[model samples]
Target: MLAAYWRGEITLRKLRVLIQYLPEDSPARWQATDGRPFTIRDAMMWRALWSVATVAQQLAGKDKNAFENMPAYPWSKPLNQNTYGSFGDHTPEEVMDYLDSL
Candidate 1:
């Protein structure tokens, strides 16, 4: 559902409802509300789900990476170099910027 929004197949209103269905602690839920801060667990779950959405979107001919193209989901952060290793160094800013630009 979120991936649908990223791909321009859905509206922000619909995305809001989809996000609202997540657990209360979900970063996506918080982010959809007001960009509130989130816990580490929230960040981890969001990233994992984003990765899955990215793959599914790609398979559907949406070249966008869910983590790199979608709206920020509250707990989004700059990847920690020491913790995330090679996958680190990216930031939600890049993704959010792309989305806004679109």
Candidate 2:
């Protein structure tokens, strides 16, 4: 999916909902929200990635910022907030490179 996104197979909106890749993985993932895994299941991964996805969505929207709050789920809403917190940073390109490396 990450590779697909990079290759322009998928839009930023889909990518955002799909992943963020967290951290603390025994084996790093290529498609991470913050640091989750190859697949994104978390609402909140990295704010940086969020920022990128958000911007792309907004730009593609009828009006910029329309979907500004694209993946506005409680990233670090609660339960995991205490332990995992919010990832808040990372780039898709970096993740893509990582995936390629693997």
Candidate 3:
């Protein structure tokens, strides 16, 4: 999704809105990837991705994946694999702190 943003496939405003549309009944939850149910962790992962993508674009003044690594699990170490490796169980505050730390 961050790549989509960089590629002009989604607007920053839209991305920000998407990060919050994580209700349990929403498609973001119902249409979970890998046939798994979407959880807060997934929401957090996406929030970080879309956010960092915009940050990178602003810093670089151009489109780029950034591919920023986000910390997940144990919640104290950098996974170095973004949030994909996460079990998608982090709390909203935890995810926010991680992103702020970035």
| Best model number under TM-score | 1
Q: How far is 65's C-alpha from truth in model 3 (Å)?
A: 15
Query: Which scores greater on lDDT, model 1 or model 2?
Result: 1
The regions of model 1 sitting more than 4 angstroms off are 1-37, 74-102
Worst 10 residues of 2 by lDDT: 78-87
- Best-to-worst order by TM-score is 1, 3, 2
> Which pairs, if any, clash in model 3?
none
TM-score of candidate 3 versus the correct structure, residues matched by position? 0.28
**TM-score of each predicted structure versus truth:** 0.33, 0.21, 0.28
Q: What value of lDDT does candidate 3 attain over all alpha carbons?
A: 0.61
- Scored against the true structure, residue 24 in model 3 reaches a CA lDDT of 62
Which digits, one per residue and each the tens of the lDDT, describe model 1 over residues 1-102? Answer: 867888999999988877667676566645544657565677677778878877997788754444555545644443332343332245667656866999
Cα lDDT of model 2 by residue, 1-102, tens digit: 779999999999988766654343424452344443432344345555666766776677632442344443334342223243323344556666876999
lDDT of 3 at 27: 56
Alpha carbon deviation, residue 99, candidate 2 (Å): 40
Q: What Cα-based lDDT does every candidate model obtain?
A: 0.63, 0.52, 0.61
Quantify how close model 3 is to the true structure by its C-alpha RMSD in Å.
19.4
